[model samples]
Target chain A: MTAFDPARFTRLDQYGHGGRLGIRYHAKAEDWVELALPYAADQVGDPSTGVLASGPIVTLMDMATSMAVWTRRGVFAPHATLDLRVDYCRPATPGETVIGRGECYRLARAVAFVRGIAYHRDPADPIAHVAGTFMLMDAPAKQARA
Target chain B: MTPPPYAALLGIAIEAEGDGPPVLLLPFGEPVLGRPGFVHGGAIAGLLEMAAIAALDQALQAEGGGRIKPITVTVDYMRGGRERPTRGVGTVTRLGTRIANVEAVAWQDDRARPIAAARLNYLIERP
Candidate 1:
């Protein structure tokens, strides 16, 4: 089993309500994190249209990727996203919770690569896919203490 | 009628008015961040899309003109964006009867080192 840390996951209080994003940490995997995007944020636009706004999906993937890195490293490393590429496969239905699992595929001294997918019920039918790289920095000594 | 939802939400201001190509700007703000202190990639895409669409809007207006809608866009993020005002410059790649292509880049600090770059394809509604 992989080591897991609780501190890496963002709590409910940290998220905005309605579309409040939630993260669930798996005890068995240190580098794997699951993100839940509630219906409020995920189901914007029209239900019949089946067109979820790309904004919320992007936000979810971005947060998930960052969390995956944070979990593996065991601390919140100061980082900036160098690039994020998202491809929309299908629109996620409103009123459905979309789950995203992100993994840090590779990490260099200063750069980290991440990839993940968002799906509603079937992983085989993904709603969106994302690939991104983040530039990491050593935590400031002061922040590291707290 | 109100302006397009995206234009209003993004606060993009039209700088020059014409059919050749339109120019717009996205004011930098904290709300556009991915991390606590970094600009969000989605926000960058939004900015790039706006700039591309605005350029197409200008071209259509110039032709006296056509309706423009987005087909697809791809962005390559280069560097981290600083917490300062940035500008996006867009140029038309092709303006045909039914399709328009545009390229744009967002820069802060120096234009030579852009924070992000993108290419956009738009479907034009010809009159």
Candidate 2:
């Protein structure tokens, strides 16, 4: 049996970049997860417009997808990002909370496929679209929820 | 390279520059740490991105300057960023009136052995 709990990472007490950006667990379900990146003045990329940096958005998507992998397997297996692609649809509106929702579409013996979108205020018009893959670095016994 | 606020948040700083774009250095610390003794992939990508922007900006300056907007970025993580200072550099491959292509690489120890690298495409708006 694997010692994996979805709730453990849901309300993550993350440090480092995630902590610096104030990333919070927003929502989650089987094989999918959503994360929140709060708007902050320091997070602004364009000082003139107060818009967020794309790099932070990329960071958010990365974490969202990484967790989605664990959620998909129902176990927290060590994994590393193999590659990630981010397509900016448009700049995020200033002073709006960006929500990133990532879904694990496929899982192979050693890889996990993920896709996600980030939106502010309205989900209809996303700020960015992301596609990525992760490689499992460790073997973990997957535990199924009863 | 002058560090931006995002770069500050990631604890990245300008290491050196000579005729070309400046090299960025990310100190290994709590702010950049990921998965215990390993650097977060996101942090590595962030460093590469700042480097890319710095290169793009320098290239545009010589051409009377313009606004650079990101279109897309593809980052390939080759190896884990270890618990050590990481260095990154962005090289502009092509600069056009309306578009620019940039490549960036991050290495922990040897420059030849990269931990991660990124390719960025930007849309340019001339003033």
Candidate 3:
């Protein structure tokens, strides 16, 4: 089996799909990390109103929270988001970038807990907030694959 | 104390408030609703979070204003929201110095049946 490498999934290469999706790793801590989403296709809206869509925001929350857990485990653990909840405080501006800071609060045997806040420039006013749980799946055994 | 700037960006309006919980009102528009005519679950989640935050803010204010961060939020979809204006309400279950628990229900026309229900836990950070 190939060894687990966290560097294989850097924010720039993993999240950079092109045109719309753009993610950058701003900082990292012992068990936490901050990600910035400059823009994404899912976040576009009416050009006149400049309202950011919510789909990208949801996707961002899912990915960011998952990354937080991945960073703490220090290995690539295949997992799926069982459930996610996001609160929209307000619509994001069209030109402004949204930042998500996620932290893994607890890691159980099979489940991990994560929470984060999405803001643009002002923390007092968050664009969106999210919290959810992920079900950790152990990497497939090498022998099992063959 | 006023509504956060982000609230304005999302166009959230707090219609009413009471001692227990606060009511938040958001207009359903094409950009927000995921489907052509149906409201997206993500949008509903967003609304639930906003209501929960409002409730948390109120609880903290009463307790002398401190730092509060979200811990976990679980959303249950009960029904599909139509492409119209919807209302949301959040109530506090447990308010402590360290943690605050809240439950919120959102619906459009029928108050008895909720389109979505959510429970959230907030970790309080004292200032």
Q: Pick the candidate with the highest DockQ.
A: 2
Native contact share for candidate 1: 0.15
Model 3: per-residue lDDT, tens digit, B1-127?
A: 3554434544668888667667888677644544246665555666777787778778788878876555556787666678777788888899887988988889998879888788887778788
Top candidate by TM-score: 2
Alpha-carbon local distance difference test for all models: 0.64, 0.84, 0.67
TM-score for candidate 1, residues paired by index: 0.68
lDDT (Cα, tens digit) per residue for candidate 3, span A68-112: 888878776666555677776766777778877787888877778
Which has the higher lDDT value, candidate number 1 or candidate number 2? 2
| DockQ comparisons of all candidates to the true complex | 0.21, 0.74, 0.08
**True-structure lDDT of candidate 2:** 0.84
> Which 10 consecutive positions of candidate 3 chain A have the poorest summed lDDT?
A11-20
Query: What is the i-RMS of every prediction?
Result: 5.0, 1.2, 8.7
Query: Could you tell me which residue pairs clash in candidate 1?
Result: B19-B58, B19-B59, B19-B61, B19-B62
Model 1 chain A worst lDDT run, 10 consecutive residues:
A15-24
Q: Write the per-residue lDDT of candidate 1 for residues A19-130, one digit (tens) a residue.
A: 2333343222455666777655322422334444454566677767877887677676677776776766766775687887777888666777898888888878988788
